[model samples]
Target: MKTAADKLSPTRVKLTVEVPFDELKPAVEAATKKIADQVQIPGFRKGHVPTRLVEQRFGRPAIMQEAVNDALPDLYQKAATEAEIKPVGRPEVEITEVPGLDGKDEGDLIFTVEQDVRPEIDLPDFSALEVEVEEPTVDDDAVQVRLDQLRERFGTLVGVDRPAEDGDFVSLDMTATIEDEEIESVEGVSYRIGEGNMLEGLDEALLGLSAGETTTFTSKLAGGEREGEEASVKVTAQSVKVRELPEADDEFAEMASEFDTLDELKADLKEKAEADAKGNRVALARNALLEKLLDDLEIPVPDGLVQEEIDNHLRNEGKEPGDSHGEEIREDTVKAIRAQFLLDEINATREVSVEQSDLMGYLQQLSAQYGIEPNQFLQMLAQSGQLEQIFAEVQRSKALDVVLADVTVKNESGDVLDLELGGSEDDADADDASDDAADEAETKPAAKKADESGAAEQETAEDVKAAAKTPAKKTTTRKAPAKKAPAKKTTATKAPAKKADAADEKDAKESGEKDA
Candidate 1:
């Protein structure tokens, strides 16, 4: 076999391949067998027809076409590997010539493939790059914020006769309409005033509404078939309530936490605030370093691939191919594709690899964010065929971490910050163990308390349900919303394979092929 690659553009390539007759023999035999199994012959049982008789009946050209189609994918993959080109999107394949078409198995199989590929990028020296991040510091205000958050967790919701205000929780019944025709409606939904997560102008409309009071507003629908379309929305507040927090004292500390006194609780909060500040600083530094690298490099994006992604995005949103959202999708898709290419090149250069522990840690973090059991989440990922994509993402992240380790980072005061971007394997293992131990310790006290108080289990279940409604933290890469049906007051189990599958599909829109 012989293969040659022609550079069509910075982000495109055309490969010409010639396969010897011997190389095509196996595919030919397999194709012959497949055809024989499908056809009925007078004196032969199904799938036991002679190759010569089948070839005579179907003609050599038909056999060659079948063999070519059967063997194309593997043949193209091998040729691309031999040519040393990292193809990105699907290739346009054309079979130019085939052997034995003229009743003589003399000529080699010839074909050409045109595809988009990763552009050659000259990465700048990482050691030469420098970025500044905020200094890791925990002030009294930060500690107070953490303490207040914890207090809120143990707070009780008391019914209020006054109008709803910011931070008040309200039970609401909502109805939406277009052109005086009701489009959607929901009743007895709990909403927090000023959260603004449900719809545009909802917070402002809900403010100042007392129990049994109704208000109307106009806003665009957030999702569904009429997403992005303006509609009239009416909301009725069923009841208004405000959270009454416990006093910051020894009694409150003992009831809310393991700490014996308020001072000890505050101290623990302060310590945690400090650790979070440091983690935030490290994340900021990493983002700054990545931004610097992206700015320094000139990576070409394939226009065809970008358009394909735009079409897919519109399709998924239930919009037409020429939807206005295509413009925005194109920009984001280009950036994501460029980032993927850049990280993939660095991954190859640094010989980065994903370990089993790395995958486990990532999966645990994701599962926690989505409020799903780790084992169940792993099963979902495997069922969706997204393990490989997840592995690639982890590899890219590690490659960036490798680059960050070599770069210099400083605080605003010009003091060099010792930001631990990525730690050694042993350190990672230790950190994981420490986290597990801390989680166990935290839960043990709660479990014991629950055993003492019968109603505590019901309260804990309610808390878990509330937490499940909270959105997951945003990551560098955008992910599709989990495909879980809403339950009355519990975290719904997600569909077996939609979240990761949608994400993988979105990222790899063009990572498939079609024969031309």
Candidate 2:
């Protein structure tokens, strides 16, 4: 057997393979037995028919074809290994020649395959890279913002006779109609002004409206039967109320937190804010490094992968392939794939592997984030078959850390900061899964943020539904609308795996070569 690869492009290859007839006899015999078990022959028990008899009935050409079809997978795998190419999708197999089928010659089986593969990357030196991170400085205003957020949790809405303002709570009745046909209506729903949790333009329309005032606005419905359709929504402002926060004092501190004094609470919040500032800096530095690397290097994305991802994104959003956002999604997908290849090359160079402890730590963090038990989270992941996806995330994160450790990070003040690579210290001596819960309590902020934000929220939601024995509770507090502004979230998007190679096996089964 011999296999060689020809580089067709940066992201594709053509593999040529030659397998002598001797190597194919096993597949031939296996195919013969398979056919014998399926066919009815007098005096010969099922699965016991001799190969010669089966061939005489089915013809030698048919037998050879079936044998070749059956053997393609293992042969392809071997060829890929010899060529040192990691294929992303099933190869397009072309059998150039087959042995002993024509009864004129018995020779090696020869085939060629064209497929997308992981591209070769010319990685830059990590040591030479320098990223400027924000100087770690937590102002009193930052701490006050956090303190205000905590205070809001314990605040009460007091009725006010004024126009609704930003941060004011409102009780409203809304009827949505498309062309005078009422599609949906809600009464006495509580909404915070400027929180665009509902339709696109509801917040803007709600502004400057007092109690008992009625207004109508046209906006695209967000969800339900009329999702994405334009609807004329008439809103009646039943009342306006403002959140009356408790005064920041010892008494309020005692009620809102475990701390007994306002000073203690402020001190704690300040400390947390500082830590968060550090985390933000770390995230920024790492991102700056990645951005620099991406800018400096020339990476070609596979066209097939980008289009496949684009189609998948549209499908998930219930939109057509030609959706307006298709080009934007394509650009992001291409960048993501390039980053994946670059990180993967670095990961390979560093011999990064997700240990069992690492995976458990990841699961623990996920469980805590979703407010479920670790066991329940594990069950959800297993049921949803995303355990590998999680594993891939942890591995890529560690790989990113490896790159971070090698690079030099400096703050704006020109001082070198001490950087801690998340999960690296305790990765060794991770003997107990039970201990992982405690270990994850100390994960670096950037790593934790990456884990939480890297995967789609829908994936976790689906998993939760599958794993929950009881239905999840319904809550009236609407999620604060996505900020009108895009937040700078430093997430290293890992490229998703192409559909499983099992499709290749199915293709072989359906080739009709076995019945030729």
Model 1: residues >4 Å from true position, as ranges? Answer: 174-187, 196-205, 214-235, 351-379, 421-516
- lDDT tens readout by residue for model 1, 406-459: 889999989888766556644453234323322221222111111110100111
Clash pairs for candidate 1: none
Q: After superposition, how far is residue 372 of candidate 1 from its true place, in Å?
A: 5.8
Q: Give candidate 2's TM-score.
A: 0.72
Worst 10 residues of 1 by lDDT: 485-494
Q: What is the lDDT of residue 460 in candidate 2?
A: 15
Residue runs of model 2 more than 4 Å from their true location after superposition: 103-105, 160-166, 170-241, 351-381, 422-516
Give the per-residue lDDT digits (tens) of candidate 2, residues 420-498: 6534544332222223322322231112222211211112111211121211231111122222211100121111211
The window of 10 residues in a row where model 2 has the poorest summed lDDT is: 485-494
lDDT of each: 0.64, 0.64
